[model samples]
Target chain A: MTTGVRRRMGVEERRQQLIGVALELFSRRSPDEVSIDEIASAAGISRPLVYHYFPGKLSLYEAALKRASDDLAARFVEPREGPLGARLLRVMGRFFDFVDEHGPGFSALMRGGPAVGSSTTNALIDAVRQAAYVQILSHLDVQDPPARLELVIRSWISLAESTALIWLDGRRIPRAELEKQLVHDFAALAAVSAAYDEEMGALLRRILKDEPADGPFADLVGRIVALAS
Target chain B: MTTGVRRRMGVEERRQQLIGVALELFSRRSPDEVSIDEIASAAGISRPLVYHYFPGKLSLYEAALKRASDDLAARFVEPREGPLGARLLRVMGRFFDFVDEHGPGFSALMRGGPAVGSSTTNALIDAVRQAAYVQILSHLDVQDPPARLELVIRSWISLAESTALIWLDGRRIPRAELEKQLVHDFAALAAVSAAYDEEMGALLRRILKDEPADGPFADLVGRIVALAS
Candidate 1:
């Protein structure tokens, strides 16, 4: 291919190239340790070309984080018909697998950068967290006590985040054991929230069984419960 | 005082000066962002003189983190008294106060450096976390089913950490409103734990009313039920 033609391939391809290499470098060192020059060199491109794709290091970091978040969100949104508990386990298992595979990038995104103000990193973390929150809230059928539902959703995310961090720290716990503990912990926490009283649990079961098939709220709630059981 | 006499301060005073200035810098920037020179200069001492007090930057960071953690622990560990709910609220209040006063330093220590691998930052974080964990566990009076008690303690800390982050992230809710919501949320969560069942709640009430100095666990149980109910 001609050099000009190769250079003009497409924005999407170049974006992916930058993101892939950036993830690799970020995973190896802290964000502050990785420079634009290093990313461009690692990607087999010039520094100017890297800038042509991403305005700056912060933008590139955000884009890389978004890419990872998108991948994670996709796993949860994928079509799956099963009991809520089973569905949640499948989703969490996928999450843990992703962490095992890309521990550094995930850790960097979650821990965030202290030197960098909480602008981009906070937005990304919030987006990912909201995705999980929406997944859990969509499952419940109760109409009263909105704050209670919010608390449950928040607690669920807290449990998952803490467990993921603990595992990622590599404290010598076997992956299998860690996953098992997380599943148990999640299920127990969910069971309590789902059944504040027997009435609530029954209502939740009904809602899950016969969720309406239309409207934005319906879709949102359906997705949440589908992953939360 | 003569210049020589002024330069020869007691060891405790010098150590305190180093920790105080280190915390100030850490609050404004990441531990990695603040250099030894900056810390020393900010404290009105030469870099070499600063090194005479602490081995290096990492040691200075660790010392600051340790002091903050120790102060927090001291505030949280109360003498045994009152209902479990009351006691828990008091302890939770202390935690909230600490965050309000030392958020920057705490954030620096928790989110500053690589979470894992060989680093003094990680060691300091681990030490603080373990100390907090022990303080929490010591407050619990789990006489049976140790596993359930473990779950309760983990869940409590999870709630506290999540709430603290949310508050720090600048939620629109008023501080009083947020604290109220947190107390309610934590109480409900603690109530659901195995130790706070209906039978135990009744027993705790009896112990609080009649027992003289009902020990740490008894005080904790009574306080948890009081706040939750």
Candidate 2:
């Protein structure tokens, strides 16, 4: 929250400061709409000094994206305790909190394809996805997830991204409800994948073993069975 | 497929031809990468004539986008018969077929921000979404679906878009399997929404009444119940 002029810092610290400033600005507006001069002024520095760190707006934008990606990746590192559903809810809470903080930049970085759709941009974005994938596996205690589990995880990530965008865009339901909806869909996806892959079925069973009777996963099972009966 | 010299046509039909040629060109690359001469050449027409129909490249791109949106909107209109699962599969088939035919264009139009992001562009894209919403309501035989049902429908459409992009981005998974996965998710989403709303629950119950006992929906329910036991 501190934006006032600070004492002279080392080169690495200065670069981080400028990139952090740029990330906050880019988080609200598109990269093209932001100017290097604006970023410099926002950081309590001169334009030339900003150029000394990043040659141009694109370089600065890339750094900002990388910084944001790193920050988001860090959020996925929740403790791998409790039921998988609880751990996932913790991760998703942080995930949605990040979305709430960095709305536009998250959309651009997460759904890379036009303004920041370069190969470099994609690598930065993929790094965040890779972090989430690894975090999910850690929660499942699966050092090597089966191929089907991997596919469903990737699909669930896509579902989460799209769901976030939709939920954010509409602001229809409360954030807690949106988080609960994600947990429900993820559990249902695990169940659906279970029909095809025994490993996934086993994983779902193992995770649900710790689930309380009145938990979201149990309710999902209950509601689904209600429809069948 | 005929692109050679053609007989003179009326103003509307000729405009359609130019737009069609532009669509094919845009399908392969972004609008910025595509040129007016290339579109004219592909249509066996002159640059001036291309401008005669559309004032400039932006206008032509917008027109082509409108055309593609209309084509995509048309694909979601499936007959309201059989189980909802079966009907959704047919619509998804045509939807994915459109994605296959207009791959790059579909990505640009559906994920509109950066490449084709504008108030006008957003309106066109939302029109396609609006069409799909109405189409789904018709399939459900619900003139006024519950608000939660509306949210899930919108979420499913977004999921379909992201899923198509991911599935296309990595051709590791076969398209048929991807399509099946979409149908499965769509059904699960419907069931999940059912748990939150009375109308959705009833709508789902009616849909499942006609759903085959061994179909994906029943299988999902059976698996979830397996965890309950």
Pick the TM-score winner: 2
**How high is the lDDT of residue A58 in model 1?**
83
**lDDT (0-100) at residue A2 of candidate 1?**
55
Candidates' RMSD to native = 9.5, 4.6
In candidate 1, stretches whose alpha carbon ends up further than 4 angstroms from where it belongs are A1-5, A78-80, A114-116, A141-145, A190-229, B1-71, B79-90, B96-130, B137-156, B164-229
Residue A222's lDDT in candidate 1 = 35
Backbone clashes, candidate 2: 0
RMSD after Cα superposition, model 2: 4.6
lDDT of each: 0.60, 0.77
Chain B alone: TM-score in each candidate? 0.72, 0.88
Task: Give the DockQ (C-alpha) for candidate 2.
Answer: 0.30
- Model 1 sits at an interface RMSD, in angstroms, of 11.3
